[model samples]
Target: MLLQVEPMIPALRRYARALLRDTSAADDLVQDCLERVITYWNSRRNNDDTRSWVFAILHNLAMTALRKYAGTQGMHVAIDDVAESQMVARATQEDALHYRDLMSALDALPAEQRSVLLLVSVEDMSYADVARVLDIPIGTVMSRLSRAREKLLRITAAGVPAAAPMSVLRRVK
Candidate 1:
């Protein structure tokens, strides 16, 4: 049982990070989710979809945690922060610009749609699996993802470039 779930840690972490948008908080959510799974998995033996079960657990945990920390999301962080965390900085300038455009488009999405889109499109979960994890109807998942992609396409086509990433430390001249 322990070994079965260990392999999912990275994926769980990635999903948590996308939803929470903070590394430490995301890790905490993953930890809580795993603990709940370990303690409760035995009782739920007929679990048809372990992936969905784990996701349902995670979704509940995230929602509970959010209720406790209502005003501390820091206004969803900045658009560049999410992109900078994902960027490799190895692409050509044009590619870099396009990548940034995509990120900005993604960043423009509401947290709910962004998360659903990431789980389904980027994470490659099926619509059913995504609905199970997110605790929403498959139809709702499809609708939100469709809207998210459409918004992204529109925003990127507008050719708007966000400000460059900022340096955290001041350099002595």
Candidate 2:
């Protein structure tokens, strides 16, 4: 099973890191998941949906962690943690300067939209699968995906709404 499951580690890590934003926390969660799988491979052997099972575990763990962190810290998980990778994919160094800007745009998104976008774009999960994973209807998954696309497009297009005047002036006091 190790041979079969070993290849999933990277993808799992990427999804977990995206979800948690904190590398150490993500790593710990993934380790815990691996431990769970190893310890319970016997019962899971009868299940054919290994991919879904793994993601379900990771997603549930992240939610639990999020809840505990929220209760203790009274803080939100910054979307920047998830958007940092998107910021890195820009075409030039100039684009890199706007990492926080991109993050802010993503931060404005509702959690539902963000989760759908992540499942579809990052995890490459199908609409039906994402629906099941999120415990929502398939139509809801599609709707969220559509809205997320609209928001992301508007967000990443160019100058910020409030900065348009300053951007056009190209002058600093």
Candidate 3:
């Protein structure tokens, strides 16, 4: 059981970090989720998808923490400051700017849509799996993903230069 779950740690960490945005907080959440899973490992159904099961556990824990923190302190994004040297070494100016724009667009999305988008795009989870993880209907997952994509594209496009004019095609029977 431990061996099976060990391989999934990196994925859980990535998901947690994406959701929390703070490395320490994401680590704590993953730890807590792992603990909970270990406690109930025997009770889990044999036929269940272990990856999805663990992901669901992590998602629930994250939601609970968010709710508790929201009531006490209100919700907000926590930005991590990077050292100038490290930043320069990571990416070129254009790449950095594009990454910043993408992150901004992702951050601007509603929590529901953001969750669905990350689960699908980042984690490569199927719509059905995302729906199960988020406890939403599959159709809702589709809707949120669609809206999130449209919003992200619109947001990012604002920074790009307009394309050259193109002729419109019309069909007449």
Candidates in order have lDDT scores of: 0.80, 0.76, 0.84
The residue ranges of model 2 lying beyond 4 angstroms of the native Cα positions read: 45-47, 71-95, 161-173
- lDDT string, candidate 2, 17-133, tens digits: 877766768889999888887887778746446776777677788788877787565336577656677656766766655765665666667877887888899889888778767
Q: Estimate each model's TM-score.
A: 0.71, 0.71, 0.77
Error of 2 at 117 (Å): 0.9
**Residues 95-128, candidate 1, lDDT per residue (tens digit)?**
9778767766777788789878988886689999
> Model 3 Cα displacement at 28 (Å)?
1.0
Q: Model 1: C-alpha RMSD to truth? A: 8.7
Candidate number achieving the greatest TM-score relative to the actual structure: 3
Name the lDDT value of residue 96 in candidate 1. 72
Model 3 C-alpha lDDT versus the unseen true structure: 0.84
lDDT tens digits by residue: candidate 3, 7-71: 99998999999987767789899999999999999999998788888999999998887777775
Model 1 lDDT-worst window of ten? 158-167
